[model samples]
Target: MAELSADAAWNYVYCQGWNRDLQRFVGLLDSDTACARNEAGEQYSVTLLRGGVPRVVIDIAWSAHYLGVWTLDEALRRDSHVDYRRLRAEQLFPVRERVWRYAEGQRDGDDDVWEQEVSRKANGWMSTSKRPRGRLGGSSRTAGQEDDTDIWREVPVFGDWRWALPDKEAGPVGTAAEHTGEYEAVSAGSPWRPPTPYRNLYLDDLMLEGATVLMEGAQPRVVAHRLRGMVDMPTGQVITCEPRWLDYSEPFTDTIEPGRYEVHDVLLTDPDSESDWWPRAGFLLRVSEAPVVSWEMALRAGEDPRTLSDGDFYGFSGSQGCFVDAEPLRTADHQINADRGREQSYALRKWARMAKRGELHEHPHSQWSDALERGLDDRDGIRLPGTNFNMIAYNCYYPDGSYPTWIGRATDGAIVCFLTDMRTTHPVIATDH
Candidate 1:
């Protein structure tokens, strides 16, 4: 037998039959040697070599169960072909026959049969559906199944040294006092709070000067377009998305009182610069003027904000721009489609007029000119010439991407605003020094 290293021996003796152990064993073998591996990188079979000759073959079934050692010929016989019917006969058929027998005994009529069928189907569906996989430590039972103690008994390492294992205990894994200066203690009964302070920025403070626009048949002159609108949210549930892509949006679960909410577009214009494009900074949907005391991610119905992991956030998709409105607007699917068609037709007609005037020169500097030509007046909302909609729409900082929306709350717990951060420019926080 080849001498094993300390790590190799410890793993072979103490962690035998584990996927990692199998992988380590295969890694040490010659690369030309054949080995069977599952999709999960779990090695199931490998031939042991002595002087580059096959000595014995080790094999493990699914999940590393039923590990067996065999001679070269025996391993060859086992690998030659599969006997699926024999497997089903030995494993599945007996359990299924027992279940059928039990059902037949309980059967009273077609109704009983129907109930059994329904129950079986429901169980099958539930078993196959995606669910969060959690580990149960020690000798705990899972989902009414047998205690894991019995399952661990089959493991080679556990079989011989089960009594040496320490008893499970319940307590905090570590204490703040143990690392006094490294940790901060929070109140036990208080509501959960964010780790960092959220910035309370004023929309008016974000204004810039000397922004210029080049109108058709006119000189490039300085112009400032501040787009602001009030959106009615009768359903309380707020939704933001590209107005035309309302179908792709979901409502925020943290709803406010049903009422009209003010939506303001944050534009960044530099008077000193020569760029014609007055890029948008972001959009703010104000719910109250009260100073915001807390901020949370605006999650949808199915999402649990409390369970959000790092890098997880609720993002609104924007193509041309974004809209802020109530969830009730989503019910008018047909009207939305009609309005979209009308907007497309209007854009086509405007383009034709621009072409007729021989003013079709490519304006590669900015999409603002294209939006202006399409009759999207920078007034209350970016409403096309003819289409009517309740949502407040405005161009985002960049043309398209996913943007995160945050919900701010006042000291008294009332919602203050919903901020869609486009990440182009940072607004001056009122409380910042």
Candidate 2:
């Protein structure tokens, strides 16, 4: 059993399209190789059986291309004995092309037929000498530097854990033999007692180590969502301009970090309105040079939260948890208006220091957290793209103890909302005065 280090640079693959049902990337096909190798081309699907039952079946071709598996040996010079460079070079589809093919494949509901088509294309290319090359061409140098800036923005802090593990005993937060749902419920005790700061909360479950299933025969759903606030390359725009999904239900709820919220659980507009729309959350940047602090160590050090950096620490009140905003608890204009009050500001300031205090907590709610934002519901909430899960956005409490309203989509994964008071409604639904 080899452990891919927590900092492994290339653990993700860019797929054809986002899978609405599975909440993962639908791997783009390598039709060229499928045609060239015949039975050997089936190297993409490597099935491992347990007691003759297919316990694990991973797509090796997809893994090699997406996770930079081919470059690992040449660049890192570590996994030298094995090579997947050939398969990586054979990936011919770009994001748009892949999206269309995957969409058609799903719409027709014919996986085998699509596979055959891909194989046929590859075979035809051999005779015509017209093989398609992906946006990242054939050179190993170009392949190594494939357009990952967008990929990184889409997923900054990825780990091996599933969004929600099926087994209650081996859950993300605990491994008790007979588990109690303490983490799931709002605590009856003081909300200030946050969950213990963890180091790689997803690493405990060994199954999360690879794109494949764990040794225990558990095939969990992959927990893959783009980080919010990513800058879209072509548009030269930050991704926050678009709305995303937020789910606060059972399966998704199980995945939430104790003091954090995911994009799927939030909504920007009221779903029941006649004209349904989703809007992206707003962000305000207030830069500070204060040293970062971690929550676990800060608690032990007995340091004042007010003295810590903005947007650094986390605190809990009963079952609710929130990270302090980088800015003081002021309205968007940065005014210390008495109307917004003081306790919330103090709370926000205290939580902001957790990052520098030596706690192994995620620095969410900031642009620096990841190439894209995932765990940020604080800086006007992070915007996650292409999610299918939904949540009722009637009104949920912000970590600052304020209840904000959200709007949701019925079919797709888009949500929009306003954090503070605002009068402008959705333009599509707004009646002419």
Candidate 3:
């Protein structure tokens, strides 16, 4: 129950889904506002966000040690003591286009072609922007705003960015595990009654099912949603609830390094189907790709379509696009699904003002030496970025990579990250913590 400094107030950011988790969390911090700094040497406010969003940035007088380094991989870490409630600005920040991500190859029996399904928007051939706008760096200014998806300004853009889901698995009928610890085994016999009626979002398929690994060399670990569960507040007969889960059995894009094997595969019993008895006929889920993180394997050249449950879990192609454009946004026509082709890469170009170019701090972020020696560019050779109340902008030269950074400290001296800038921009407070 902390408060913001008089100079700052909690600014509102957009919510990802229509879930009540955000609204209730807002009530917790009176809007758990945050403050963090960017390379602009200015302080801004931000609403912390979760998932593949921006790292919460606060308005700090000081920048981090890697402020002038050219490569990424040096700026990865967890948050510490900073007044997250008292934010640095309102929105979140986008990547500098240095850090990048993409879909890896599909495995045997991966029915869903994640890459092909999500490629239309990756190349910039078409779009759905009414104003022909590109990307929305979460924190925006009117006149300063233009249709520039490829442009990197250290600002938070809230548009379309997705944590590529898992590839479906081909398997036998998956069984459902009871919501085990949810309620202590009540009755000794059959009809076990409940204590206090608390509504649990225990989807029949999501109740921790068994897994079967299809890939011969793949890891057989049965990993799926890490921290799983929902929060429910009873409302008389019915209960209101919000869902949250640490689905850590994420798929990797196969950046198979030395000895470390990439983790993939999730045991999910897909719900719903044309069948009446098993209305959700596809009860079992043993996709070729492991969990989401495991699919974070090294981006390959031909990681197109893999079949799992005969359905499609979309994916994006073209390297480094995640840091800038929302690719393959949608190919088919809203009215005519058949006419749709691909989501063209909405461009986001970056060019410094005449004066700013000469003094470009090419190697602005240099904290991690190993990356420095390797000579990696901030997504697109960006140095200094733009800033505002809740964001910073990284002007991107290439639409591929992302320039990741260390978010700053808010007032009152406490640290907590509300935004996570993996690709798209803007910071909404993360409801988990």
Candidate 3 Cα deviation (angstroms), residue 170? 58
- Every model's TM-score: 0.40, 0.17, 0.18
**For residues 1-433, could you state the per-residue lDDT of candidate 1 as single tens digits?**
2232222211111111212211222222222222233323233443332222222334433332233333322112211111011111123100010011113333222222211110111112111111122111122221322222221222222112222111331112110011111111222221111112233243333322354433223334343435477676777888876665555777787888887767776555556788766655567788877776677667776553322222345577666455445445555434333435558788567667767887655322123235434433444544332234456666565667767777778888888888776655433222212
Which segments of model 3 are wrong by more than 4 Å?
1-122, 129-150, 154-276, 281-433
The model with the greatest TM-score is 1
Tens digits of per-residue lDDT, candidate 2, 50-91, equal 212111222333322321111111111111111112222333
Best by lDDT: 1
lDDT of 1 at 217: 39
> Which scores higher on lDDT, 1 or 2?
1
**Candidate 2 local distance difference test against the native:** 0.22
Worst 10 residues of 3 by lDDT: 239-248
Model 3, residue 6: displacement in angstroms? 18
Q: Please report the TM-score between candidate 3 and the true structure.
A: 0.18
lDDT of 3 by residue, 1-433 (tens): 2222222221222211111112111111112222212334322222222222222322222221111111111122211211111112432112111212222443222333221111111122222211111122222222223343542123232221111111231112111112212111232221111111111112222324444222213323231332111111111111000001011112223211112111111232223333322111011111122322111111223322221011222222122211110011111012112212353221111214322565323322222122223222232221112211010111222244322211112343222111112222111111212
What C-alpha lDDT do the candidate models reach, one value each? 0.41, 0.22, 0.20
lDDT comparing candidate 1 with the true structure: 0.41
